[model samples]
Target: MNNAVTLKGRTEGFQIILHASASFEEVVDQLKELTVQLKKDTQKGHELIFFVDTGNRLLSADEKKQISDIIEDEHFKISSYESDVISIEDAQKRAREARPKLEVRTVRSGQILEADGDLLLIGQVHPGGTVRATGSIFVIGELKGIAHAGFEGNENAIVLANFKYNAQVRIGGNVHVIENRDENLVQSEDIQFVYVNDLHIIEVGSLHYLKTIRPEIGKHSGGLF
Candidate 1:
């Protein structure tokens, strides 16, 4: 297969490295074979997540999907993609999306709101409502509905909301249901950050220490984090 694909274990997790300067078809073929071998070695009913690292190669969205299609299996999931190259045009677009957006209206029942990057919502998210962002979510009002961050597979994204009411938070592919109803948990007192942990489970931590947890979150995001 010309070493088109190499699977390696990283300190953070496992990654499937795609060789640069190789034919796309060759890479695809190797990916398929590697995934099959991975499945054979995996325990029954077990799942594995892999980050695709395309060294010196910038892949189009369709090409990314093609790789995903090859590695997809009952036990295999493509967590995210790492590319060493990006066109100037794409970089500019990403720069624009990196800015946090603001929403002032309340999210009513059955309403769904989405943002390409970080979202700074100034209104409440009621039950039966939903909010999703490719980055993080910073709500100025009560978040009683569902909030999903890193909806596009960036696990580092987070959701900031009061934990005094019931809600659902999703970070990447991990989900956590919040049922806290204690009145003591008010804004500024019980605001929590929801995110996917190292264990790939959705978890929450106190906002008081958010700086220690994700200090860099304010970078290029307009401090919305």
Candidate 2:
């Protein structure tokens, strides 16, 4: 019997699902096309997510190389996967175990907070304020400064905010600075989160799932700024 591989795209990046009976070359070609399409869409102001299924086998050397090339070129972010194919239940358990838990309020200047779990900022993260985490960072108010997620080297971590006015942002060491903050900024009521998928750090809507499932108690009552 042949192996089957499935590729799926999400709001932040892509994943691969492997079944049985598929050619590695074909999968790589399809991924290339998907990357091109994603790039074009992003250029046009459209956001997308991606995923893949690798039934159960580890990626081939050549296939890994192709994926590495795409990631190096900044095509799209990569999320996560099992080192080996596991049962769906096992995968879910792994995901739950991998998620982080974090909390904060009133990020002041000259202060830095780092955590292995998701971070929640109830207020603004002021200029010169820095927060780093291995999971996702959520800000209920404005983000007027810098925030880094996936700090412990977990590329799957995310950073989220209600209003993005940050001078800089770093997710998994990928830095993005707002050169003209006065001109280019995102002002919206919606929550935003950044995560790494497919080797890229991408922003996406809300962290409702994380928040609901892994609620963190507030440690500091002050504002983050």
Candidate 3:
């Protein structure tokens, strides 16, 4: 019973380890006992964040809900659940989602181009056309149309284009209309990127600044510059 549920303190946070070989009922019973003891030892009105580690055990939705319901303390919150196993289909799907989708055709007027993950376009987006991505969007040609990044509510997503002097850019819930900018500077051949700043406002900066924002964007590519 002692081995059914174990609690350990780590630098990241407190961890509640569920025994891989223990029966669900036994684990629940031991967890209940430990929670009662912890409640008594802890000071009043203190919040506790715990990471639930299911070592080598995959829990169903109902099972996870059951454990959550059992830990019914207002001051106790479960930050996340960690499992050691993933299905092959899930792994494959993640791989696909991680890879950026690339297209080489112009997005004509009235057309809407979208990607599940990042989108890399080598053609221009005519006015009245729209390009949307669940992740980031990189345009090598003129972007005179609407560019919506993080369409799935990913605030960290960005938009990159050679020049977007007169276009609409959106990241998550924020939007920025590219207009009245220095036509000479913004119309340059060098790449410029658009992102959401700390204050949640849209910002357009040089390509070099992208490394500081998302270093991983250069993973498959040669370099950020």
Candidate 4:
């Protein structure tokens, strides 16, 4: 009964936590109040996607629909309530393993760099070097080697590089080999990235269009990137 429904904002989005002991009716009422407050907040441009968490409770389909109906409105969308947050210890371990940064001068042939989370490289990948990650991979320098992102089956992960040559890039299970091109075809500082499109094919494009195609990665929602 205490704090039956709680709403918390995160950098990526918001989280709505429902207490396990609360009755369905109570939860629905709290959701209504939350949405009303959210409406007011939206007027100030404080809009964000939100995920629901039914702590220690498995909601029935009808109950879920009812909850969704209560929260269905502009500026508020329900992501899901099925997955629970990981334990603090597990989170810490993930944070350590997926520290999000790995800087090296140059990745030589046979050299490999991998990450469980986003990987940021400040140097170049030589012709035979390799980089693999479960999340997005960002290379600030030239990339002429192999780059594989979404290694853990995340189709949304992307591979970005400041200078592109003939590199083998893979996003999820899709792969694309950038053929050697005339250097004059692109600007000296041109940046490019590879990703999986709606048709499930790997495509190469400019970084400027990344946000347009994959907003979730830009926003870091659901640890998507």
TM-score of each: 0.56, 0.43, 0.69, 0.55
Give the count of colliding residue pairs in each prediction. Answer: 0, 52, 0, 0
lDDT by candidate, in order shown:
0.84, 0.60, 0.86, 0.79
Give candidate 4 regions above 4 Å deviation: 1-89, 96-99, 181-189, 221-225
Clashing pairs in 3: none
The per-residue C-alpha lDDT of model 3 at residue 1 equals: 37
Hey, what RMSD does candidate 3 come out at?
4.8
Candidate that beats the other on TM-score, 2 or 4, i.e. the better one: 4
Runs off by more than 4 Å, candidate 3: 1-14, 29-50, 74-79, 86-90, 180-186, 208-216, 219-225
Tens digits of per-residue lDDT, candidate 1, 1-225, equal 379999999776689899997889999988888878877898988877889999999898999989888887767788899988878987765875679888999998899999988899999999999999999999988898999999999998999987667888888888887775655544345677887777888777887777877777877844322
Cα lDDT tens digits, model 2, 1-225, are 233445565556656564445676765666566566657666654444444456556776676667657643543545554454555765654454354444547778888877655666777778898887766677777687888876766665556665445456777778766444566445555665555545474545465664543344233233321
- Per-residue lDDT, model 1, residue 217, is 89
Model 1 regions lying over 4 Å from their true place:
1-92, 181-189, 221-225
Candidate 3: global Cα-lDDT? Answer: 0.86
Model 3 TM-score, 2 decimals = 0.69
lDDT of 2 at 188: 50
The residue-by-residue lDDT of candidate 3 on 103-205, one tens digit each, is 9999999999998878999999999999999889999888999999999899889999865458899999998887747655445568889899889999878
